[model samples]
Target: MSETVTLPRPDDWHLHLRDGAMLTAVAPESARHFGRAIIMPNLVPPVVTGADAAAYRDRIMAALPAGSRFTPLMTLYLTEETDPADVVAAHESGLVTAVKLYPAGATTNSASGVRDFTRVHGVLEAMAEAGVPLCVHGEVTDPEIDIFDREAVFIERVLDPIRHATPGLRVVMEHITTQDGVAYVREGGPDIAGTITAHHLVINRNHLLVGGIRPHYYCLPVAKREAHRLALRAAATGDCDRFFLGTDSAPHPDGAKESACGCAGCFTAPNALSIVAQVFEQEGALDRLEAFVSRNGPAFYGLPVNEDTLTLARQDAPVAYPDRIDAGGEDVTVFDPGFPLHWQVT
Candidate 1:
């Protein structure tokens, strides 16, 4: 076993850096560990065009802490009204690295998302022709499907048909959470990959209900069962190029998340690596940690691996709960912040 290891710094293939204050508050956490992150475009008035992506990129740049080496890879939010010409322009101009497809009403700020895949045929064709990837939310929004079964159902109903319609299009199944999701992405063939989030590797549905409902563990494509969590761990650590890291580290203001109708998202920025490291270590696959966290993402994105390096150590430590960046507003706790972590960032 390798006593110590270092690898190219990782990038977050999927992330939601909300605009303005929230953006300013959370951008630094990711910047601290990642060299680049594919920024999600689902803002209030989502980034639907090249100009919007460019402007959002500028905001992310300005928000970065001084001397931070982080780069924000922008994406266009795909809506039914998205123009094929705009997608072509964005890809050609290099303003966007990918296009995000959120099934309408799937998650936060996704009300503007495309309601029907058939309606965006031109945009998908344009993206494929331009060699840009389509990053999907990958869950059906229909009310009848059980919350836990939504992803599997979407894979069979929505994603399968979409893939059939656009044979050459590159796709990333964002934040995959189920065995079915893992299996689907695995069988979907090349030019297709899935991003596994750090939180899902650590928490399952039992964590949500066992000790009474834990609101902080709530996230879109909500945590699945222990079996699914185990499946995610195996996929992330296994020799599958189809899976990699995407923290999906969304933040919700304390008021919004702790309310009667609590929002779905975990502010996992602070404890992400530690949580992921713990998972790999528990599976006796710490040696494979670097690949899942550092290598697979850039390989899928077709970007060169990072030159910088980071370390993870087998040290038991406690990441504080209610992470406070300011006074009196409210304390924000990461998904598993209060718990003791067996692996720590070095």
Candidate 2:
């Protein structure tokens, strides 16, 4: 006998659909599972302006398979020189859903990110007034801070102060990987929420470092200790609207990931739904799956839950996922949850 759960088609609140060939290859994977996604804008040059977001959205639409209803909710990449009026105007026109903040040198293609938050003060104020949410890659790039402590330090040194000063600014702490992150979002009142990645809920630092380096498990705001992973699971599976799903389903080609200096990302787009469903079930909170994946995100973003539905069934046997997906010629590795996956979206 099999148990099944049907929910509104989910959204990926934080997703990376990289441009050109990579975009064309991976956009369909996300579209196949999610009804809408707040697409990341950290392209090489970055999508900094309204025009850039529009053009990128057009490209994403063109890349999707015909008749697919995948809506790419676009975003602007924040920089020190970003204009407040431009940010508010884009949100008002519905040209972009949010503005992304990737602190300088924080992650892939983030060299153009902000080092001086003070420079973007007016823009943050304008966003607050206009109800424009800011999706942040919540890690500090300070060289002195230990890599594992960046997220907590960032919250203490940067995130809290910013939120205090910029009241009413709706902030989504994207791919939060710490207990501190969970606690902050839970206590930060209505204006702040956190996105927990499928990978984070499933993997920890051990999965990345134990028994040799697993490059595919490496991601920005990299997975933390098992305790942190447990907190994320509890947060995602509990009754908390402040936490939602954002696979951060970043795809890097095989060569780039398997390099002398490998890139940090996990291409989990292909199996995100299945992985998430299994995690929810294991935690004995399958009842909360709909809210975490489908309902909570739209509520936070001031959008409606998707009318369409996705069905997931628990099977007696493990569901097989491909080891790699081809991008042009190179293969992008799919995330393996380290445990058998029984629940699959149909």
Candidate 3:
């Protein structure tokens, strides 16, 4: 016998649909499962203004699969030179949903990110006044900080101070990977929330380095210790509304990922929901999956829950998913969870 579960259509609070051919190829994978996605703004040159966000949004809409109802919630990249007025206008015009802050040199395509947070005071203040959420890449790039310590260090040195200085400023800590991050969000008020990626809940650092270096499993604010992974799993499965789903399903071509210094990301968009279902089931929290994927994120962003629905059925046989997604001529490897998945979107 097969078992099936249905819930309101879900949304991805954090996603990276790169531009051009890559965008064209990968957009459909997300569209098939999610009703909306908070599209990242870290493209080449970055989307830094209302105008840039609008143009990028147009391109995303153009690339969406025909007849698909997938909406791309656009964001602006926060830079030292970013204009507060432009951000306000963008939000007012509904051209952008939030502003993204990538600490300079923190992750891929972040060369244009904010180097000195103090320089963007006015912009942050304006976003607060206008009620625009700031989605952050919560890791510091200081050479002295151990790579595993960046997220915790960022919370101490950067996140807390900014939230204190700018009251009422909504912030979403994107793709949190540590127990410190989960604890902070659990203690914070509604103005702050954290996004837990599908990959983070299933894998730990050992999966990336135990026997050999696995580039496909690598991502920024890279996976942490087993204890941290267990903490993340708990946060996502618990009844905490502060934590929600954000696949951070960034895709990099096989060539780019297999190189000596490969890019950092996991292309999990294709099977995010399926993998998430398996995790929730493993945790005996199937009843809470809808809140993590659909309800909490919409509440945080002040958006309406999707009216549609998605059904996942558990089969006797293992589920099968494509190993890679074609990005123009190159292939972007899909994240492999190393365990058989039995849930499939029906």
Candidate 4:
């Protein structure tokens, strides 16, 4: 007999809906499964001020499908020249949700990110005072540091110091990919939390480089060893409010991804809920699925749990999902979990 589970509609704590054609193509996929999402702010020029955030929010609303109730929670990309007053004003007006910190050259379109952390101290202080959370792309870009070691090094060299200096600052370490990251969040107080991506829970570095280089599986803070993957699985399945779903569902054109130097991201929004449900069932943590995807994120963000519900059912036949999302002129590949998916959102 097939089993089914129904829970409150989930919200994506971290998501990337690129502007223009890409946004129009993928926003509906997320809207179909999640009620809201914390939209990333690393566009070409980046969203760095209250006005930028407000205008971007308008574009997102315009891109949404007719009659869709999905809401985009906007964020500001932090830079050295970022005005603390602008961030406060944005939060007060509900034009922005949080501020994103991307270390210089850490990931795509991050060239404009902060190089000297001290320069943003005033902005961080203002965010703490306004009760606005800081969503961080937790990786250091020092060329000397190995790519796989960036996240772990970031915690010790950067994250810890910043949090210690700013009291009462709420932070969400976005897309944590290490055992060290899991342990840090497990031990942190209520003021700190971490978001675990859907793809990270399923793939490790081996999946990206085993027999051949799989660009579709490649992502920033690139997947770590199998042990780290297991740690991420445990954190996501455990009953901790600090750990929640964030599909970092980034999309790139096929040509761009298959090139000599491909971008780093996994496009998983098309079937994120199904992929996550399969993982939860495999780990024998199906009971905690609702809390992980629905309750915890809203509680951490100080928002209300969604009133609507989503239902997933296990079918005898494997679930079928589109292999790619057609973004106007280019095709964006969907993440393949290397296993047949049986659970599907209904």
TM-score of 2: 0.99
Off by over 4 Å in 3: none
Candidate 4 regions exceeding 4 Å error are none
Q: Cα deviation of 230 in candidate 1 (Å)?
A: 0.7
Q: Least accurate stretch of 10 residues (summed lDDT) in model 3?
A: 1-10
**lDDT of each candidate versus the true structure:** 0.85, 0.93, 0.94, 0.94
Q: Write the per-residue lDDT of candidate 3 for residues 217-325, one digit (tens) a residue.
A: 9999799999999999999999899899999999999999999999999999989999999999999989999999999999999999999999999987999899987
**Tens digit per residue, CA lDDT, model 4, 1-346:** 3399999999999999999999899899899899999999999989998899889989999988899999999999999999999999999998899999999999999999999999999999999999999999999999999999999999999999999999999999999999999999899889999999999999999999999999999899899999999999999999777999999999999999999999999999988999999999999999999999999999999999999999999997989999998999899999899999999999
lDDT of 2 by residue, 17-78 (tens): 99988988999999888999999999989999999999999999999999999999999999
Q: What range of 10 consecutive residues in model 4 has the weakest lDDT sum?
A: 1-10
lDDT of 4 at 157: 94
Clashing pairs in 1: none
Could you tell me the lDDT of residue 111 within candidate 2?
A: 93
Query: How many clashing residue pairs, candidate 2?
Result: 0
Per-structure clash totals for the candidates? 0, 0, 0, 0
Off by over 4 Å in 1: 1-3, 316-324, 327-330
Cα error of candidate 1 at position 274, Å: 1.0
Give per-residue CA lDDT, model 1, range 261-306, as digits (tens).
8888887777788778777767989878888988888888888889
